[model samples]
Target chain A: MTRVAQISCGTEYSGIQWLLSDIAERVGIELVYPEMALSRIDAACKEIGLRAESPSLNMMMARAVSTLADPTIKGALLLTCFKCSEGTIVKDTIRRYLSDRSDMPIISYSNVEKPKEIELYARLEALATLITRKALLMREKQEGITMGIDSGSSTTKVVVMKDDEIVGEGWLPTTDPLKSVDKGIEDALNGAGLKEKEVEAIGVTGHGRELVSKHVNADLNLEEVSVVAKGTALLSKRHKGDATVIDIGGMNNKLILTRDGIANSFSLGGICGGSSGRFLEVASHRLDVDISELGQLALKSTERHELQSYCMVFGIQSLVVSLASGVKREDVAAAACRSVANQVYENQIQEMEMRPPITFVGGVSLIEGVKKEFEEMLGVDIIVPPNSQYAGAVGIATLVSGI
Target chain B: MKILVYPPNSLILADLVERAGHEAVVLMREIGEHVRDAEIDAPPINVTEDDLKRALRYVSVEEPAGLKGRIGLLTPLLDKAEASVILSDAPPTYGCMGCAVADEFFKFLIRQRKIPTLEIKYEGKEKLEETVKGIMEFLVQLPKEGEISEKKG
Candidate 1:
């Protein structure tokens, strides 16, 4: 396992250290707490030359400086508790200090006691993928007959591609991951009118990638960010200088900044049903319409109502209030769509620069109400990549073929 | 009844807790007594190096001495707390306690103390009204007499 340096204070006390270790273990990476004698901490403190009030702050600066000085260290995790003013300053200073000097990739977190599982998985998995599969991430094209599966939280998706073109794809709402993967890959093969053994390689990505990949003995188990970028690049084929890829799935949302076919930076949204397709699912069900018809119903509404909170429960509370006041169903649908788009913007997009040639991929991108709202809010035409919803499966299929 | 408010010393959370007829056990109350004492030479910094060293029992020894110092100050308030009103994920500007490590440790220790704690995740702009209402409801619902009663046999 590749060792990633940990530069933070008090993760052990808050019990986040064990959770970090658990995530690192799950992702097949290791957390390296840079250490020396407690007495030598004074010297480490002196070497960094920081006079921060807390000894922990000083310790973090010392560890950060030492880690940056060491060239062999390929990755580091810089962290600070969100509530610490001094720690934020220290975190920013060291972050810039390291970013300027080191070639190593570093992930920063402003944390509380309970860490979000998906966020940790994405970040550590990104680090793990970068360290392990740099060449695959750099590969520009797909080769041979490869099958890729996205065993996501709410849905399982598979795409079978030959050379550079997709021959077949399968998508199903997820229940049991093992069963879903079994069915999805079979469906894709059936759609392509090909036997399962005909596939040259298999790659998997998403929340359920580990289990599914282990079951299949896959070629590549890549992270969502890299695969999504590759898939978006393949499908978009637009004027491809600097572009942003947005994929809002059933459980959470992702925004990736891309340069050519590769990811430069990415952010996954906080665990909120409001920022995801599940919110729309609930909205569509409550409105007594099929999920497929929600976009058309939203388009018919002349008036726009707003939902107050980005939490699904609170957003639904707002939705209920609007309905109680006898708001038209069309208007409520529009509000629900607009609320989802707004939350995605506020929670995810605002954190990253929205480069032009913004491609809206994933199942949510198919909703015209969402696409229209994204366009209206950003004041730019959003590109809905062809087979946008199949981006992940297609992406992994492309990546595994490169290997 | 004494209710501890996190940020360790937020006047706002303290005031709201007090409005529910409970004494607010905040750092300022403990530190007020520390500043008045003649034994500790450090005026503003109430906890001495030895005092900070003594605080090792609260958190791991691997932690820095400064965080230990901060935890030392909150110990008195923790001892007195019967219930707590903690607004989590608030910006550093909200409390300005300086040490983020100790900030987390304070919350962890309070939770370990097993008081009737109300931890509201802080959301600015959109959910302030609801959060305040949540705090009020939580404080009102806390057992007036003492710890929650055991079920009768």
Candidate 2:
């Protein structure tokens, strides 16, 4: 069993001590509680120099620091009761410290005295996936023909990759994902000038993945975090050691931080599609331009217009108000892009300490206006790698190639 | 007789449901089996491979992966629920499991479920006894025996 350090306070009293260890051990992970060094506790606290009062809380932090010293440990599980305000602060501190100091993946949980079993299971499962699947996430190249279907909410994207390069691709609106992937993959296969028999493996990802995977018989099925990280690694070699990926999709957004091509930490959220590709699609349609024309149209405008930048509905209302007031279509498009970029920055980007070189992927990434806004916000050129819109499909396909 | 306690995972809510003559369909009931089952080997996650595949019909893929895994495990209980006791504004501590993302989304599914539901906000722990009393009252009102007998008959 792979061992991960268990760094926490109050598990003994919470009645979940056995359950936590049981869950970890059950998942082929032995919880590595730092060997008791009662004398070393104060010294460990002094080393980090955090001024926290609770002895156990201090010890939890110290144990966290000590876990960093152990090479046998593959990952860390930090736990604290929901009532422990001090524990929460220390938990975040240790998480940041461990992340900044080492490549060990970390997950934290706030539990009640008798925390539910499923919650623990899910958290541990996610942690296990990070450890057990590291090789797949860190894979640098593709070996054979692999088809990846990214069943995103707004679009179904499919890609056919031969060896290490993309041969054919498909993109279409996603209404019924199970049905969409059939035609989508067919189009890609047709473009590749190959029969279905030539394809070796299939990988499915994104929200529509399970439905499509069932339809297409996928060999590799994974969530977007690791898949996107792998896809970005292939697209750009600039930050092979440490990098960040931004993917704003139809309904939500993903901000992923990667170390050595494996996603170490990520923030997944995009409330109301306010800061996503859908907003741009809606605004572009309103402006009587194709979604593909939005980026250039936004670039053409010099006038700065403000739209409600938080909620999608409010943003659309602002869009209506701007058009009613005779704002140029180009200007309105620019405002929409700016609004999306700003919301993404606020909601997702700010969640991680973005380590560059940052690669932008997803349908929204193709919009030069969104790219410019992100570049302006970060003051660094955001690389929208070749075929950025097909990131999920490319990601899944590349991963499936290994199998 | 199945009362799904909203913001699930509360021993107290489950107990209240029991006191009101109903079995509480809960996260603990659903996930606990997978976790503690001796036959289910180590790396014992709640959502099995099949469970995740089946859950796709319930929640969208766009949800956080955690949410998807949870919705899968929790929905079976949701489907069995004849009633639900929903708690709001209470910090999800010491129980009130359903009140917590996976927490929000699962509770949302229960809310949307076509079942008799009672919504209550926890004033505070000092008032928890009163809150429990209110929850007990709602659980009692559920058509437990009558509905089951009617369907059976």
Candidate 3:
């Protein structure tokens, strides 16, 4: 069945196109590419003597309209970038065209370098849910909840899952991994309204996984990378395809390239305070701003002041000097975000052929500024899944559910 | 009195020195300036032509070329100090471990100047407190004005 038609600019970054394809595959939807739809639209427009103001926008509109004509195509998704001025100019025209012709569910999203993955996923999930609800009604409900625990170097995440859906989740800073894991598990269990004995199984992952496993008697003790891959794949299953996953945690950053549903290749940042969560936290402390507010503040920047060094100590000093020289806080914050993005790109991404539908996960993915910087630098729409910081935990939960 | 602390990047030592009401002159302050203003393309260390040339003399005993540069960078800071606090067992902190050669040179320079020095071993919490207190007491008892006490016993 024709699941959905994806309309996008021909010049859209290859990574994003790959992601769209992946999402379509995951959701078991057929995607009619713009090229195929454009040919039909071009022929029709020629016959009707219609002239489009912007060729790309015209093509996108034509493709969307033509694809939706097929009764099998349940939904239409229009993908455009923030930098596409032509798309912006003709947005209303396309909206009018869709509203006038198509009764099917349609979603129009403007892609940017840094997009909130959670919000985008929610919208995508809603659309998928809308299209697949009837089919879903025939499936059997999953029994009992399973617990997944991630005891990372900096934070502990616990998730309780009932089949494919997350039932309860909790996260806490990891002062002592053992204590933090216990607390996180307790909190998650409490939220799920279950006792320890009620949980069918428990799985664990992260830097402190072994430490946690030694103390917590988990059914499965999975490697951090494998679990992360599983979690990313599960969350993004609605969009089945390959993506480069960038996970920046407290002490380290991991770059995993997923092909189909498996990890094809991966690289890790060295043991330095240069491109991890610690760097951002230290920068936040030096700036006297809460880390949570850094991204929004960065969005307000009119100009960016790039950090001269990648080292956290040096970066903090540059920040101090920038503040002293009357530079706006937002600009400095934006610059700091850019520096981190640059470090990750230069040190890791540069060495790898990063395919798109790139997903950013882990604690640092929560930072909007970092996401924005990654998007801008990578020149693609980056997808951040919901509860990104708990991706490893979620992955472990998904793994144990299968058993 | 200005007290030069070894492993110049120790923020804890810098904070303690300030708390004790004495100028804490550490090499990291100078290094930090370079790191902060360094151009995006510049190396981590901001080594000038003069610094490289001056550092060349110390290259013999210091096998690594970077250590000589660090020694040259720290010489001026060491020269201006009236006293020295050598953190014997303190682990190297961020931006502080440029060159082991420079660390050895720093000690030699302090001895050549016959500056009032206190060597403290940073072990446990209680010992660290005792060491800090000892340094503070030593700073307080140092002779006033231009009289540099001849290497206190």
Candidate 4:
């Protein structure tokens, strides 16, 4: 079948690629990976006098624009991470460029570390619906529904899928994993307009997956890392390349290296909360700003202050002092983001032999300031996928469907 | 009068001491000189060659209980002080473990110097006012020659 072209940040996409693939499959739309369109992008860039720059986002955008220009490709899906530096910087440019150059429908979406599953599913479902409608014009098929429950340390996410099409989704802050799971599932079922019996298979993943799966009775309990890899591989399948997935959560972070669509090696970091979502939370509290607004606030900074302390406890103190010294709050926020990025790079990323296409997943990747700092520090354009925070849950659901 | 304060980074106590017509001496102020843009809350301290040598004199690397480094850092401040305003119940604002060790060593060094000191807990409202007054009174009452004839335990 002729496919919808997907152009995404390589790193972020790897985390939740599986969910997109599943959605595409169900919608009767094949996904044309941007990697497959690199040559076309290069040719287009040369033909249009566009200079390819160091760091891959520009090149990626070129590939996306060129790929979507193809007559066979039905539409384009632009998957971005919340507050992703490159995404924020290039999204408008890509949209404007594509809109002016091509008549293909271009849909843009963002993902964060914490899964906002309901909203994500709704957006994906709409896109799938659109793709399916287009596919119906060319003749296609439909599939059954499957359910996935991700009981995270900080939140719970539930996604109900009809084959690749997301039927319903729900997410809530987790006070009690069991209760959150029950609530999320209930909400997802209601949203999908389906009964529990209609869900052909149920899968669970995340820190609280075992607890949730045991209590809720799931058909499969998948490892969070494996599922993340599978999901990422599915998303990046069109690339036909490798990626190092960095999934930073509230409590822990993971680095998974993928080679030939397989997870080759992985590392975890959580000894200190300095490099996790908790660090940003602490900074937000100290600054007396809402956590959700921190990214936008940080982006306003022209000068980045230096937060030398690696420990969150010490870092907050340093932040307070910096604020007291008349430094701009935005600068301090940016500095804090840089400090977190520095800790992660020094402690984790430095240890790994990172190849191109580094995918930053987990909840922390949602922060634009953090993403920008990571890019500056790593000297590379990091890819952030859509619904990055829900990669594990989506991956588990994919695994369960395979069974 | 030169007054030494515990935790070395309490801006409240330092400002209070300065207002009471005495020079407030804190080791952190000295450490801050070596680092750029050091904040009042948490000063980034880099132990210099001179600091390491001074610290080694009081505590050896073999049995350095972490107290010796603090003692070495605070020795210069303690030597210049005629009195001390110790916030006995003031929790360490930052670096609690290191501050705790420094607190003990500071008290020990103050006793050896026979300096007149007022130790009080941080209480809110009227109690805080009374504590500040008490510290001011104690510092003002010290001999003009900068000597406390009898140290009170």
Candidate 5:
């Protein structure tokens, strides 16, 4: 007889959690656990059978691991919900504990959607069980694969990987993410030359993932921030040490810290609607210039003026006044750069006491002036990865492969 | 050029001055904060001649705040012109006070034999303009010699 164990982070009446429980019941996987602390897993298991314990995450995942060691257990699954970062730590800890033993299969998942896609959920559960069962036959060895999709307000990305190698990557404007996500998935799938059925599991990450996932489902749904760290780890071949990802998109900013290929602490902005990329786009259109030329022009500025306006409307007026006064365009450019760099510095950098090498990601990261201004303002080197644009997609690919 | 002047507190009025192409100078920094604060509520506050003088000196003479010390600020500038217009975009009580102050100041200039041919028009709008026509239509009606003289005393 096969025993399958399911584990999940506690849900507080979220729609996704209810769907996970419903799907588990339909798939005939016993929903044997509730949200608990690390210490409780041992006691939960003593009532059933022996299980493994997670050293990092508290009692939430202890029962699943302890139970996985039983020869009678055929498969195991880990479940999590959205707005959940602690789940990553739990998954990482469990993976580390099960690194050597492959007797019974184990899988990890984050709830993607509700009951309608229960079959998709069942297939993934079955795949996880199959992988675990297959591993027991192999000569003690480990394999990894990952895939990442970063669906942002302005852009969408996809990356596919086989082990550590980046097989395929893509970055495109996020005009209509549903269509773009499909294209991204197709690109990554084709690059890997793996059919939908051949791929053992799928994972998704991003702001627009909820809508994007409707077009394509994943075995796991992860938060965008963790995925960025995962994607950057795979793409940061240019540097040697831990790197910070400064993701400046049309609407928000994220600062992620990665050390030795793991995300430690990360922070994100409150979507206040004003930042470098959006500002540059508006300024360039108003000045009737291409955005690409904005940075270079700002770099040439010699005169400097403080932009006194607190909002965009006021800023526009100030710019007009400066122009009337014949403030050198270079000075205006420098001021513009300073304005954007200052916003980033005040909101993102002030909180971090330690300065680390910064990596610029997202669409805005491509702008030369923003990067130059950030470096000039901080007095530190800014790192822009070659594949920075596709980091999220790459991270998704890494996740798909790693499991 | 058409202009709209909403001299809500007079700073806006000063901004309209340069755009209005008048020789009016708004001594910005010299203007006291209390006078501005008072102007926002009751008509011309308990401002003394000394306080007005102190306020006028530091104003961006050409900016909004420079038009302190009432009508005198407009006297020299009005005298130098062949024609000038003033617009008021406030309630009747406050607008009349501002208009009376300007009339008094214009007549004071005339008493000193500094009066110039000036036209003042008054109208109202939901927003202020900074153009000549807008100014002529919104706040000041054509200045009459009798009204101007009566306001001066």
Candidate 6:
């Protein structure tokens, strides 16, 4: 009998475990439940019926392969479910564990099917073959290239993704809303190293979607709300769960609520510039400082002031008045962060009935101080992903890999 | 327990109010004729000079019922109203502020006399709920509308 060890994370005694158990049950292989997995190998070893001799990372792998050393035992498999973040990391980690060992074939896979009826035996049988050789790309070749150009009043963003990895992405200040979109699209295609003929379809979004569609042909044109929601869903799929996305653009803001992978509702801001990016830009000009270091300066604020007004005009006036009253400039900048957060909370979040794991994006996400204000008010941890500013582009690029 | 809200004829606002567990009676002036053609609820109320005295809890163009007409009919209804609330959308339209009528009526209801209340800008249902909750909290201490006396110099 071939000893097969299958490990599931965050799914123990849950839906996934039951599915794996059913699969193992049908395959006629006795399962050695490790109970819990502190690390990837531990879980693998337990499911394979091995003694926990030495739990070190290297030792664990050695034992895993040695147990599989017998020709009777064929391979190993790592299983993940839809919307499982830890599963992705753990699956990769375990794959790395058995990568060099040719004797024990190991493969990682995820199932979005209902848990009650998982075909573990058939899946593992197929995985067994894939492990021995390179898996051929079964997907069809590019029929044509499709593009999603997102142009706002202030910024232009373009993304082209194939097979769900970022193939090409571009961003530029929207000097000319109409023309910059075309330029951004060209830049994105060049970065991807693909020609316009390769594109299959085109999608346009943002306030200028209509204008863009008028300029360049598109397969589909969606509102900024739909485009952003679609983009956010693609990015958050790797780490699943309900997430409130706060996009703080230069001149406006957007609050999107997503659950399981679908956007439930969304709200966008008006043409107010009190939000962080535009605020910092204007503040830097008034204070004669660099915008990049504004976050660090705000951190050194000796005193904090409250900006009470919601109107941008009144807010600017209030800032000037406070500065004239001898308030430290750093403190004044800090107050702007507070004001932005308050506006987000009062107008965007609380008004829209948003929930957390709130992900803050947009160009201003680079500013640490503004993020801190959000964390403070929401009283929950805020997650800012890598390439925070380029998330829109990254989201668009990820579309190629997804169905 | 029953409160009517008029928002700036924006479906987005009605959607927000519905999400907040409130019965939002949307009054849309533009589509009133179509709604009338469909022959639903009470005939479309007509906008008139008398709507100035009414205090609305919410106002928006999202409601298919004529905003002006509804306000005109509600002037007397507001007199019998236990309480009311109003929120205006961005770039407040003349109808939102009851500008087609007299300004003194709004001043009396919102500022000086404070009969009901009027809030300019996006007075979303979230704020409306907060106001409702506040009123509920003060219910025990509130004097009867007629029994309570306004301070006079």
DockQ of each: 0.04, 0.02, 0.01, 0.01, 0.00, 0.01
State in Å the error of residue B70, model 5. Answer: 49
Better of 1 and 2 by DockQ: 1
TM-score comparison, 3 vs 4, better candidate: 3
Alpha-carbon error at A262 in model 6, in Å? 1.4
lDDT of 1 by residue, A254-282 (tens): 88876667765567775577889999999
Q: What are the runs in model 1 whose C-alpha is more than 4 Å off?
A: A1-3, A25-69, A83-104, A116-119, A238-242, B1-153
Q: Model 5, A1-403: lDDT tens per residue?
A: 2345555443211223344445555545554453344446456445433332222123444555565545554455555442234445455455435533443344555432232363335334443334332322111111355566778777677766665666666666677888888787788778877665655556676778767665577765655665665566656653245567787776677676554444444445543445646776776666666777877777776656766652456765676677678887667666666776677777666534333767787667776777887888778888888777776666666555545
Candidate 6, residue A52: how far the Cα is off, in Å: 63
lDDT of 5 at A331: 71
Which residue runs does candidate 6 get wrong by more than 4 Å? A1-146, A236-239, A271-277, A391-403, B1-71, B74-153
Model 4 ranges off by over 4 Å: A1-143, A235-239, B1-153
- Of the two candidates 3 and 5, the one with more favorable TM-score, higher being better, is 3
Among all candidates shown, the one with the greatest DockQ:
1
User: What is the Cα root-mean-square deviation between model 6 and the actual structure?
Assistant: 22.9
lDDT of each: 0.78, 0.76, 0.68, 0.65, 0.52, 0.52
Model 4 C-alpha RMSD vs. true structure (Å) is 24.4
B-chain TM-score for every candidate: 0.86, 0.82, 0.76, 0.72, 0.32, 0.35
Pairs of residues clashing in candidate 2: A26-B42, A26-B43, A27-B43, A207-B61, B7-B97, B7-B98, B7-B99, B8-B97, B8-B98, B101-B104
Model 5 residue runs over 4 Å out of place are A1-147, A161-169, A185-202, A238-243, B1-153
Q: Which 10-residue span in candidate 1 chain A carries the lowest summed lDDT?
A: A10-19
- State the lDDT of candidate 2 residue by residue for A253-354, as single tens digits: 878788877778666663357877888888888888998999999999888887865567788888988999999888988889999989888765764578
Model 4 scores a TM of: 0.47
Could you tell me the lDDT of residue A138 within candidate 6?
17
**lDDT (10s digit) by residue, model 4, range B1-153:** 678876566777788777766778876676666455443222124433355356555555442322343455677887788778777654334112132334565677677788777777777655867877886777677654334324431
- Models, CA RMSD each: 14.7, 13.1, 26.5, 24.4, 25.6, 22.9
- What is the lDDT, from 0 to 100, of the residue A277 in candidate 2? 85
